[model samples]
Target: MHKPQGYPDVSAYLIVPDAAAVLDFCAAAFNADRLRVIARDGGGILHAECRIGDSVVMMGEMPDGPDAHLHLYLADAEAAFDRAVAAGAEIVQPMQSQDDGDLRGGVRDTSGTTWWIARQEEA
Candidate 1:
């Protein structure tokens, strides 16, 4: 009906070269749960959704796509960053405390999407 449960009003939609790999990376890197995958008749994923934290990220397969940059706030940003690297994501920035009261880092997944992970200090 009106937006799915546990999904934010504004969600990020990503189109990548390999939707399946991105889905798997999201699961491993962010502990996201794969929710749905609608496949094309010929082949490849036409659409997919994953629940990362309280947000639902929609994705589809598009070769050499326009890359996306997503920022995520997590309880343990370091662990998530480690998991992302272990899952084949290239580290673009190291985790470090920021003046804005957040520990942040970044990584680029194989699908060309860059993820900025942070653990925000409680105000």
Candidate 2:
């Protein structure tokens, strides 16, 4: 087996109630770039790929399975937190400096997916 271009060895797949809205929110909050989208039979999204920085995330509308949560590392944790709040994401945990020398925060999107965002502090 060979690795695909622009994909990491492992990636996250999200199942949300609204994939399109989630994509839009990610664009506004995390500056994610849409790579591809596949529509479902009736009216929802079947699959979609989005890139946030160098990381790629795949997602789709809710299926017969459990939901997913993700922990993300950002280059600018503060800015990302503000952007996410402004984009209507509910703050699950406020940003704070950790003993490990990192800034961390958490937010829940409209679809109820929680994201833990973090960034290492400058030396």
Candidate 3:
């Protein structure tokens, strides 16, 4: 089957309580770009798409419970970790340089989604 234009082979669909806030946080913390957003008449988001680097993440407000966590990759793990913290995310793990040569860390967003941010260390 042919894939849609501008979409990756795999993408994450997130259902959170507050789609708008999550979108904003992604933009501020990860430099994500808002691709599209559909809002409900009742003042909540129905669906939205955001681009972080070349990957796109689809998100919407959940009708009931919380959403699942996600893992993200950044060129600079430390900077992304700090930006996420400043944007109201709490640190789940401090940045560490792994033996495999990856810098990684974890943070939980305001809506309770955990993100594992990492990058391959330079040679």
Candidate 4:
């Protein structure tokens, strides 16, 4: 039998040291619209999803290892970078428009979580 047709992409999850804490920070810094959260017995997040603009950001408790971070695509990376910095986020990488057609930069939030912001050039 063949698998039924379905949405190609459903969701993604991020493992962090503090899911609830990070969720709050993301909401404040990026205006994330939290969708749902499932908390585990040990206070770790079992599952969670948030919406920043049209894109969805999924996060949960970090596994037994190092932390993880990811990048986000925006219309104006420079503007986003500035706002994040003004909000007390540390600059991990300075803003620069790359030859590959992207304005990119990095910032580490107050919780020590790093985030990359970029703007892809229009084709």
Candidate 5:
């Protein structure tokens, strides 16, 4: 199957209770760029997409959307974690260097998604 240009081989799809909150949190926390939004007729979002680095994150608003967890690798995990905290995310795990050669941390956003942010610390 042919994928969209610049899209990763695997993408994360989020089912959120509030698409706007998800988009805002992703923007503030992960530095994700909003790509698309299909607004639902009454008031909420039907579908949306955003880009974080090379990955495309798709989402839809539903009353009973399931929660999600994501492990995202970034060039600067520290800054991302700080932004996430500033954006009202609850700290799930503190940032630290792991024995597996990575600096990692975790946070839970307003959308109920736990993001595991990490960076390579060694080769």
Candidate 6:
């Protein structure tokens, strides 16, 4: 299915070692609105959905695979970057307003998953 522009047209899962903790951190730091959480016997996240603005980001347990990364376009990437750092996120990329009018940066969560957060400014 194709999602409309400015809405998330794609979804990716971050397979973290600690789904619960990551979920909590995302909620607290980025104001993630958790929509669903499904768990199985081993305390792994079977599935989950979170909304940061118009984007829906999903997550699950890594289940012994390569690390995962997620990208997001926020309303204020610089503010979000600062907040994430204060909330214990590792800085992978410094915040800067792009030439194309996007305030962008990258950070690695405590789970080692990198997220590229950005906010589009009017041209």
Clash counts per candidate, in order, are 0, 0, 0, 0, 0, 0
lDDT, residue 16, model 5: 83
For candidate 5, lDDT tens digit of each residue in 1-123? Answer: 597777788888989888899899989988899998999998899999999998899999877878799999999899999999999999999999899898999999887889999999977
Off-target runs (Cα >4 Å) in candidate 1 are: none
Query: For residues 73-122, could you state the per-residue lDDT of candidate 4 as single tens digits?
Result: 87766777887887778899998877988878899876567889888866
What are the Cα lDDT values of the candidates?
0.93, 0.87, 0.87, 0.73, 0.91, 0.77
Candidate 2 residue-wise lDDT, 3-121, digit = tens: 66878878789988888988998999899999899999988999998988888888978745465688889988789999999999999999998898889999998888888889998
Q: Please tell me which predicted candidate would have the highest lDDT against the true structure.
A: 1
Lowest summed lDDT window (length 10), candidate 4: 1-10
Which candidate do you rate higher for TM-score, 3 or 5? 5
Measured against the true structure, the TM-scores of the candidates, in listed sequence, are: 0.93, 0.90, 0.88, 0.74, 0.91, 0.79
User: What digit string (tens of lDDT, one per residue) describes model 6 on residues 4-107?
Assistant: 34546676667777777777778866898887889967667787777777677777776454667777777677778888888788988898777877878888
* Candidate 1 C-alpha error for residue 80, in Å: 0.4
* C-alpha lDDT (0 to 100) for residue 39 of candidate 1: 97
Judged by lDDT against the true structure, how good is candidate 3? Answer: 0.87
Residue lDDT tens for model 3, 59-83: 8887564657787778777898999
Identify the superior model by lDDT, candidate 3 or candidate 5.
Answer: 5
**What C-alpha RMSD separates each model from the true structure?**
1.4, 1.8, 2.0, 4.0, 1.6, 3.6
lDDT of model 3 at position 38: 98
Query: What residue runs in model 5 are displaced by over 4 Å at the alpha carbon?
Result: 1-3
